[model samples]
Target: MWFKNLQIFQLKDTENFSSTDLVTKLPDHPLRECGSQDEFTFGWLPLIRNSEQWSISSDLCMLVRAGKEEKVLPTAVVREELEAKVAEIELVEGRKVGRKEKADLKEELVFSLRPKAFAKRSDIWAYIDLKAKLLVLNSTNAGMTEQLFKLLQTTLGSFPMVPLQATVSPSSIMTDWLVKNDVPASLETGDEVEIQDASEDRAKIRFKSLEPLSEDVTRHLEQGMSVKNLALRWTDKMSFVLNDDLTLKKVKFDDTLKDNAFNDSQGGALSDMDANFALMSLTVRDFFESYKVWFEIQDED
Candidate 1:
């Protein structure tokens, strides 16, 4: 599946990574169903839709998925049940329930209700680009990404990586691009932008479906606002919102890219998947190579 957002990481010690290594280790942490009293469970899942293969390699890129299962117990329902129990106890004893006793009652009630709670499962996709020495995840949330990193580390025995950061802040470069209307030739500015004040007030202004370089936007730039997020189209291949933290949000590939991949597929499901992944990974590789210079990404020795 195509990733809708991007969280990039620079993979150190990439020489030690291989598809075989990941495939061998994935079984150690296969996704398990949540237990009755367990709040959540985290583990690995097969990357392909109908295949047991946990790793798919295409054009030097390898894809894997992390699965999470969480119990869903509505807070309102728990509160209602707890209140009814507390009320019944007060009526029977003709006295108010103590705070400690009420806490214990809520705990007992939750444990009892845990088995009936619905379970929700979600899959997170990620890929490792061997050529680029990059690990890209389909998530922008720090906590969720950290969970994946932890799982990978535990499974593989070692996962040396760090979040990608530029020598100059992304916001600083984005702000300059907006102020000068001199974005890189390979990239085009889109209609949406978010600007925030550098001062302590931290006021933010969001503009969507409007000209990002219009006079209104210029006025904000003149008044000490800087670009915190900017929408960008990457050489007619894909579009995404580039954030100050270097995460990409709302990433969408062009129909032509999808069409080409489809046309190249061999009419088999597995062939179709391989073709799609090959195209996506190659396109992303080109995109990173095109813009990484601006970010001044340093290679690990």
Candidate 2:
């Protein structure tokens, strides 16, 4: 129910699509059971539990899923079957099977096994800040987010999503933080850090959670190595390993943030879903706002 990570994108123009437009186009790509020939399917649905569609609002949230069906007969299995068939052909014809004949046998094996393969589905929830003109994907994987992006382009005739990036990688900022040997306000450095050399070989240095920079970390910086991963805590709200790409990994929110929404003020039987939703939404909304400056500057140019 909570987003673990975000692959952020900003909407380009409001004139191209509207809430009504999304409502009209979304139903055209509803989820369906995978067919024998269907390799993949994409569609959008409700963001909340026990709902069927998106509601018009300042913030537009939707659940989208992509289903893929693949008939993957293992190479080892196919190889064994092919070997047996090749031997059988050789024994019957009094000669070895040619490469072309072996390829044909493999194709036939796949045909026989196609009906037994299983389908796998992956679901991603997305939030569109209609007022702010932003799209937030709840996936850290670029491939998964791009798949959904392409699907939007296919269904809507246009998709204007530029990934949120900074002109300077977060690594540079982290390097500066390390160089100054100073902790920034409202932020505390954790014991974990990764410093890598800027060369083809890319030599690396990793520090454990219980270890401090002390001397080894400083020596790497002196040698012009850059920060690849740094563990940091943001004002007791969450602690995360911030990557050079500005992606947060191993993010954990504090209970104080959760307790406000999941309250039991009325004898432990409170319908606090809306409260939780509001708090989570606000928390996520603030998360974007906190990082927006980093991207906005780069986007402007």
Candidate 3:
């Protein structure tokens, strides 16, 4: 599947690591369904839906999936039940329910409800880019990404990675781009932009479907506000919103590229995935290379 968001990390000393090694180890820790009382569970899953393969590996990239299953026990429902029990006990016993007893009842209520509670499931897609030495995940959620990191570390014994840190602040550079109306030749500004004042008040402004270098955008830059997020098109092949923290949001590959991959697959599910992965990996690798140059990231730090 196409990645929609990016949380990129720099991986060090990966030249000698075998991508197949990671794939082989994934089966040792396949995702377990949540137990009756478990709040949540996380584990590996097949990269392709309904397929047995846990990973799709190539010399340049290895794609994998992690799944999270959680019980959806509503807090309000639990609180309502607890109150009813506490009231019944208080009335039946002709006494007030003690604090400790109330807490105990709530715990019992939650434990009883967990099994019947609806299960929520989601998947996180991540890939190891051997060419770029980057671990990119299609999630911006801190908790989800951390779970992936922890699982990888446990499964492989070592996952030496750190959040991508560039030599220059992205906001600062984006601000300069708007002020000068001089975007890098490889990238073209898109219609959406978010600017925020640096002052403590932190006033933020968002513009949609307008030129990023328009008079209004430049005027905001003139007012001491800097770019917090900006939508950008990369070499006419992909588009995404680049955040100040360097995370990518709203990522999308050009439809032409997607169409080509689909046509090349000749209409089989597994072949489709393979084609998409191959094209996506190559395109993203090129994007990352340009990103490093733009941000002056000479090497992983």
Candidate 4:
């Protein structure tokens, strides 16, 4: 993000002015625009010039054009031939070699520099949301897709014990399989069913029907919900089973869910979803683990 505002400029010299002369006069030039005291004190004019071709080589320094009468200063030298000159200047100034020097040196080489472009938060989030919608629309395997949907619901429900609900039409056998196998169901009387996990074994977990969130919930999420919020909501519903340990153990999404979600969204949102999910899980787990370790250390006598 900081790199976006960066600008580089190269120095231009007449036949009378040598590159060394330009470099020597750099400190006195008025174009220096360091953002902080550190930048001001440590920054240097980067110089770029060639003895052979002055025009093209001189075009290799950085320039910040703020206003009229603001003399251009060199930040770094791009020409390898000028290394000895650079070292000589450094030795003469008795300046220490460090990041500030490096930054200043880098600043000198370009003849012209402009800020880099960056995407806005709104634009990035909109892209992610659209990607999710596209994945849902294009999946070919209805059954697998349905299974994936239920898994998504189970893994990403509001309540850990209760699973999200959806309807399965008689015509949609694939949907029926997905609901029955991928999604856990608890029948009430006739056609009505709910999802719940079985307690026989922790390994053989099942889905449970969760009460649907009101419209207000969706509105609240849309207003300012972050990726962290969504991840936390989903992890809470999944009984905190998604973590680094679980990841390293070769745990994977339910096959039915994977088939459908991947088959449908693989070409779309689901393509890079797994890697993103893994990164998110690892990040959260590491943060919490570090906090816990700190807490334990603090509690030590």
Candidate 5:
């Protein structure tokens, strides 16, 4: 429920449809995990396992889960077994196993082992923030996010979601902010920043324990280095470092989040879990808005 990383998308369809419109359309496209009969499965499912069809709250947030599953048979392991079988067949046949025979044997081995192959699953929690006009996925990987985008499009008829782009480069704004030592009022500068060389190799440097962000960092900034990461606090709610690609890492939610989102475990565990999910959904929305405001202010400046 708590999105560890935010990959934002502008809801291009917002003008024609509202969040309330999704409840009807989304349920039909529930995720189907990959099965023995199928090679792969990827789609949207209710966040809860089998219980709810769609998880929507009064806050205008819609919960849709992205599930991807693939049958995993390690190629190396398969090849080792195949090789041993090929050798035994060659010895019994009193000749080298020909290309066609080896191929057939490999196919047989794969079919024999596939049912025992482990299934790998990737489930990412995602939400559509109707109020913010954004769809945020907890996944940082572009491929998985694109899968969600496709799922949304398939479910809703058309979902024109594009990766967030800013008028001003975040790298430039972050570097300037560091240079001036003028971290924004709502943001408290943390003790790290990552810089990468602008050369062809794109050498990267990560500086930790640089509390004041001075000396070598200032010199590197002067030397045409680009800021690839910046650490900062969002007032009192949380602290995190922003990567060059604008992904979040090492997020630490302050007490406000823990208290509200997780509430003290007084009620039955299931009720508490439900409360946590709701609180987390709302918290994620508020934080996104706050971060957007902060970045937009910088972009404007």
Candidate 6:
């Protein structure tokens, strides 16, 4: 039920700015309405495009009370003005190419955690009533569906007075593995192989690519030389700033740089490599961190 009735704001033109200004302005907002409970409030500034005229945006989501009336006051107005002022400064400094424009301004003022709440209730019979609806509307795989059912069971199990009726489906992975690897019995050329009992032996696997590994973790792995310290070192240097998913979202090799790599016959052209590394490092570092929390969670688990 956390983050229920949260207020989220999208600043359509101030995505590349630091959070210092916003953090300073937070105390002016109606914090009393957010309640005394522990909550999360964060912002993300994304540089959507770069050119003579650049486009930037920010996402600001806050967790607050359900019944609270959201406030739009002089402070909010000042915050907006401050963001515009910062953008102007960036443009003047050549940090940003041109004037920033606000586009696709959308405000979803009233939101609730209804979906998560429903999945956490003790009313499985009521949940079953929604299964058909979910199958029609949700895009979840069977594995995810089973996971949800299990989560619901664990949630409702504590409430013994309530009877649960939801049925858990078999995991999709069980079916997927069978379909992918199961040999057809109708195959004529294959030799008959004897079935063997499964063993607990685990195989050590190493991945090697002829092409350069283009991921932050890959770069760290290639540079760190220690698998045991890779996660910790990468986290220290790149955590909260790089995202692996987004880094590999698009694999673009600089052909120009590649050509230059071969063209420079003068054996000591390390500057080009240095510059390329720096640019690639910065781009991957910034865009990837936006979704790095998922990687952090995986590591922790």
In order, the Cα lDDT scores of the candidates are: 0.88, 0.66, 0.89, 0.25, 0.73, 0.24
**Candidate 6 TM-score versus the reference:** 0.16
lDDT of 3 at 126: 93
The sequence of per-residue lDDT tens digits that candidate 5 reaches over residues 1-301 is: 4556766666665667656666777677766756665656786666566566466553766766778887788999989998999888778988888899888988888788877788888887777766777777777887787777787778777876666665567888788787877777878878988898879999988889886368778788878887898888877877888875666776777767677745644675445555666666676667766666545622110
lDDT string for model 2 (1-301, tens) is 3456655667787566766676677767655656665545555544443465343343354334343234455678878888888888899989977888788888887777666666665677666665556676667876667777876887688877776667667777787778777656756788899999999999988988544356778777878998898887777677778788777777767789778656632322223433444455556566666665533434322
| Tens digits of lDDT, candidate 6, 88-189 | 757787674333332211121112121111111111011111111111102123343343334323433321112111132111211221224321222111
RMSD score of candidate 6 (Å) = 25.7
Candidate 4 shows a clash count of 40
Candidate 3 local lDDT, 56-166, one digit each (tens): 765678899999999999889999999999999988999999999999999999998999998899989999998788898999998899899999988888888888788
| Residue 160, model 4: Cα distance from true site in angstroms | 30
The best candidate in terms of TM-score: 1
lDDT ranking, high to low:
3, 1, 5, 2, 4, 6
Local error of candidate 5 at 241, Å? 1.6
TM-score: model 3 vs. ground truth: 0.92
lDDT of 2: 0.66
Whole-structure CA lDDT of model 1: 0.88
Q: What residue runs in model 4 are displaced by over 4 Å at the alpha carbon? A: 1-265, 269-271, 294-301
> Between prediction 4 and prediction 6, which has the larger lDDT?
4
Question: Model 1, range 161-196, lDDT digits (tens) per residue?
Answer: 987768888888888887888899998889999999
lDDT (tens digit, per residue) of candidate 4 on 1-301: 0011101111122222233443343344322333322111112222121122111111222121111112223334244524654687679998756766655655554322212211111000000011111111112233433433343233223111111111322213212322233222321111111222223542221222322132333233234321110111122111121111111111222344344445544453323343333333333333333323321312111
- Which residue runs does candidate 6 get wrong by more than 4 Å? 1-199, 203-268, 297-301
For every model shown, what is its TM-score relative to the native structure?
0.93, 0.78, 0.92, 0.15, 0.80, 0.16
Give the TM-score (vs. native) of candidate 5: 0.80
Ranking of candidates on TM-score, top first: 1, 3, 5, 2, 6, 4
